[model samples]
Target: MPARLPYAYKYLRAKKKFPHVWCPGCGIGIVMGSIIRAIDSLGWDLDDILMVSGIGCTSRMPVYVDFNTLHTTHGRALAFGTGAKMANPKLKVLAVMGDGDSMAIGGNHIIHASRRNMDITAIIVNNNNYGMTGGQFSPTTPQGAKTSTTPYGMIEPDFDICKLTEAAGANFVARGDVYHVIELDGMIKKALSGSGFRVVEALAPCPTNFGRANRQGDAVNMMELLKDNTINIAQASKLSKEKTEGKTVRGIFVDRDEIGYLERYEELCDRVLSEVKK
Candidate 1:
């Protein structure tokens, strides 16, 4: 039998209530495990953490974790998380969303949230399809990939989530696939520990939806693809875009420390209060 982890490791307040509703062989479990472990490593109290999720398979993550959670409507997690952070700046706000939920319907909110640099962490689980409603094509689906909506093949290009977040002024940005569970966990911990808007885009496998439809092979094969196709950020910089064709650039893409939106607001509030007292 496998050795069990210590109480602090697996004895999170919500463990017994979890093992969640996600399907077997789904990558969401791996992502959730990493996030939960990272939260444990941070030694953050469940009461101090708030998990906000939008509609989708990945959105169900907040439901399992024993945090103060909000299961919001589709594409609204960013807005809700932003409001929550603005209201209680001390709270550790995490918005969990899926590719279709974040990049498609929620795309506008994501760009603006990064622009605002709110004190919130956005965890985007990119499975490259509309996994819940159906295996429809999504904004992150690779070019020429087939989906229920795209019987032939997807012709549109996929979104480079990390690049987009960084370009939009997110203070911290990172990318890791489900295949790199430990790496993904570390990245999540880093994002949570950082101030300001941080985005971690996790490339996960949707075997039931994306994989079966695209003939993308089994779960293990999908993970192997993650291992084979991903190149480190440093190596990616050395290669031309064409030279690194078909490669997914992994690792910490960007991390720049700056005052988060809430911190700035507090400073302004202090100034106003002092002036009023004067």
Candidate 2:
């Protein structure tokens, strides 16, 4: 059936059984497809992979994939992933989180984990507002944007995810929206192959809740917003915030070659062994 679906389609099949819980036209599916394709491209063992997620609509991703996943509490996926990596040291841990999950409640863990440069890949689905939580204004929601919590218009500032992660010491940081499917796939693949802490913030859409609440309408309209409102780093640098208007910065923002957290720990262990032997 369907020509046995190629070996490269391993991760894509899960969508069939799970169907799509996200609203039609929502970009979470697109982002998920890109992630699976990336994993397939890397030829990583499904058995050796662990997909951990925190609370939210995006966090539900790990459940649909056919990998060992831990759907943990809100904002705790990174911590759990860190422990898992430290224990096994062989498992390829991927933490799937939401904007609020990683930037708000879990912000501390994110920065500390980045500082430690753990051998883990973190994929953050940033749909601006909290889709699962009644379209509330999240840490990344643009200033003056309407949300459940800020119906009159938000007055607070937003966190540029890429810059924040890079400054916090993440070895690798990248940003890709659902609109850029190929780029998303490549970034995810690179992050997984990387040695130290990696973060990929995927700008997704919440057409049903956030879209309607913010007057952005259905999924198609939301996608159009992404197309019109996102900017690349090169483009962003040339333009001022006023010129960018409603646009956001997209694309890979940082990448560093450094010793992974576990690798360094192993080195420490080896040194202890050598000293004892002497």
Candidate 3:
């Protein structure tokens, strides 16, 4: 008889609703696996977790996983997730989006969600360019990067997803790359275990679209780039500014204790009831 697979496969082992639509070597699949393993390690009931996604390459994640899922319009995953969390605070809500889906069209929704500090965990896969609609430059695409839309090289600066969310007041914010799978898993698990709005900006490679346009070679080459280019927060503190220049920082940037939206809403409802009683 064949040996049994690890416990985490319990999630993947059960439901394969469809063949994943992601391209070979696309890191979105790795991100999805990290999510599943993290959730499994946490032992959260699948029924109580609500996975939501917007239109994009990464947004197709919910199609394969066995969880309560909602596939919404482009730039609206957070909007729908916020409503679900408000309606049923007991449910664990997770919003998955690609860099383009969240940072471009859904920009306002993410900012408001972070400011609202509601109970939601956002997993944003930043593969530089838009993978689904075309290899177009996105808000997170690096300056001077080549893409289908920016043949002359992108001119504008890119938005740092973690920093943006932190400034917007998310309770927890972290940056992780698909190359660091264990670290990514830990970050996602920590984000899931927290309250208020949390965001995990996952830097993944889009070898199919983004990579092809930029001539980043295959998925292995992109993974090597991640390994060399990113440094963790702990090690970064010891390095000089010049040494770390042009390198990406990965790890938890913010973790704070703050009241979530549901508690405030409940308090208002109680106040209204007490006023009527009087």
Candidate 4:
């Protein structure tokens, strides 16, 4: 008989959901495993966690996990997650989104969430295209890349999600790649443990769509490219700008304590109640 699955396997839904719908060589499955590993390492009870997602290939992750899951509308996962966080401050809310789902249509919501410093975690799996609907160029699609919407080549510059989140006042912000599962797992764990708004941008590959359209080879080739094009933040600091040009810098960009939205709201309520008593 084959060896049993790891303890984390218990967290998955029934065996019927086994063999996920993701295409062969897609990095989404790897990212999902990293999330499960992160949650397991933290030792948090499943009941205390809520997995939320919007409509996209990556957003489908919540359906496979056995946590309190919410599959919200397109580009509205963070909005729903914010409401859930406010309703129960103690709940550990995690919003999983695709590059298009979070950075394109939901851009406003994500930035506002960061500005508010709400205690919630968002994991953005950036595959550079709208993998679910079609191979359409997303906000994070690199310049000069080809997609269904950009057959001539993408002219718009990509948004650096980690920097965007950091600038918006997120308490924790980091970047990781599917090619580096160990590091990705660590970043997720750290994000989960953090307070206030946290965002972990995971660079993944849409082999079926983006890869084929761009002629980026197969999934393995795409992953190798990701590994080659990335540098850790610490190492990047020592390199000259010219040397690091066009490379993805992966690592924690921001981590600091701040008063979260829920705490501030509760404090305000308490103060008002005391003034009324006076």
Candidate 5:
């Protein structure tokens, strides 16, 4: 028999749930493993960790993980996670959202959450299209990429998720690819270690829908494309935009100290209470 999972049984649901819903050659599994490994490395108490997700392929993550999970409404994972964090500042809130879930319908929540500097770690799995919803062209779908909804080709520009989060005021923001598991894991660990709103955009491949439609060959080919088309942010800085066109830049874009929402709220409450007593 194949060796068992590296994680303890407590970290997963019943074995019956094994053989996840993701299709063959899906990179979401690799992203999931990186997440589990990041949490394990942190040595956090499972009970204190709350995994939240919105509707999409990546959203299905919380269902399999054995932590305190909340599978919420579509494009609202961050909104719910924000409330959860504010209610119990002790909880480690981790939100897993797909590109469509995070950037499209949920875009407003993401920006506001970052602006408030909420203490939540968000992992956005960008497969370039809406993998779960008929492989539709999402907000992050590259310009001129063909999808089920864009048979001719998409005409809109794609949003750089890392840049969006950083500009929105997230204290920590980074990008990683499923093809680079080690680097992905390290970035997740770093995001988890930081306070205030943080985001890690993980580029995953949806071979069945996105790959086939885009003529990207099979899953292996898709992975290779991800590896070859991406450049580290450090190296990208030295090159002109023309030279970096069509390249997905990956690396920590922003990391700095900021006052988290909960901290600020608590201070305000204390001040108000003292003044009332006086």
Candidate 6:
């Protein structure tokens, strides 16, 4: 038998939850494993963590994890996560969303959440297209990339999720791909260990739809592409522009110290009570 991972089993549902609905070689499972390992490495209590997700392939994460899970409507993961964080203030809300779920219909929600510095972690698994909904082009689909809806080729530029979240005032922002499991785990763990609106964009491969549409070959081909095309932030800094051109840069982009939404809310409440008593 393969060596058992106690940490993984401690937080994940039993083997009865097997036969997940993702494609045979989909990278969402890698992302999920990274998440599970991150949570385990952090030694966090399962009761204190609230894993929330919107409708999509990545959204199915909550169904498998043994946490306080909320499988919400499409494009509303961050919205619901914000409310949950506000209501309890103690729960560690981790919103797992797809690119389409985060940037397409729910674009404004992430922006406002970061603006408010909400103490929640957004794990965005970006597969370039809508995997579950027939491989529609998402906001993160690369310009000139092909998708089910973009048969001729996508005409618009993709949103650099790290830059967008960083500019929007998230205390932590980072990018990781499924091919680099260790870095992805570190990014997620570091994001979870902090306050403010943290965001980790995990670029994964949607082999079934995205690959077939774009002629990206099989799962191995896509994963190999990720390995060859991505460069770490540290490594990228030392390389010249010509050397780094067209590479998908990965690593922690922003990690700033800022007070979270709940902290501000608590302060306001305390101040109001003090004024009333006085």
Which residue window of length 10 is worst by lDDT in model 4? Answer: 1-10
Q: How does candidate 5 score on lDDT? A: 0.92
Q: Return the lDDT, model 2, position 55.
A: 94
Write model 5 residue lDDT over 75-166, tens digit each, in one string: 99999999898889999999999999999999999999999999999999999888887899999998888999999999999898988989
Ranking by TM-score: 6, 4, 3, 5, 2, 1
lDDT of 6 by residue, 1-278 (tens): 55875657777788677778899879998989998888888888899999999999999989888999999999999999988988898899999999999998989999999999999999999999999988999999998899989999999989988888888999999999999999999999999999999999999999899989999999999999999999999999999999999999999989999999899999999999999999
Cα lDDT, model 6, residue 68: 98
lDDT per residue as tens, model 1, 140-205? 988899999989999999998888999999999999989988889999999999898999999988
In candidate 2, clashing pairs total: 0
Better TM-score candidate (1, 5): 5
lDDT by residue (1-278, candidate 3, tens digit) is 45986765566525546567888999998999899989998999988999999999999988777789999999999999999988888899999999999999999999999999988999999999989877899998899999988999999999999999999999999999999999999999999998989999999999988888888889999999999999999999999999999899999999998987788789999999999999
Estimate the TM-score of every prediction.
0.92, 0.92, 0.96, 0.96, 0.95, 0.97
lDDT, each prediction: 0.88, 0.86, 0.92, 0.92, 0.92, 0.92
Off by over 4 Å in 6: 1-5
Tens-place lDDT per residue, model 4, 118-145, is: 8899999999999988789999998999
Give the count of colliding residue pairs in each prediction. 0, 0, 0, 0, 0, 0
Off by over 4 Å in 1: 1-19, 235-243
Better candidate by TM-score, 5 or 6 = 6
Candidate 4: residue 34 lDDT (0-100) = 90
Candidate 4: residue 153 lDDT (0-100) = 95
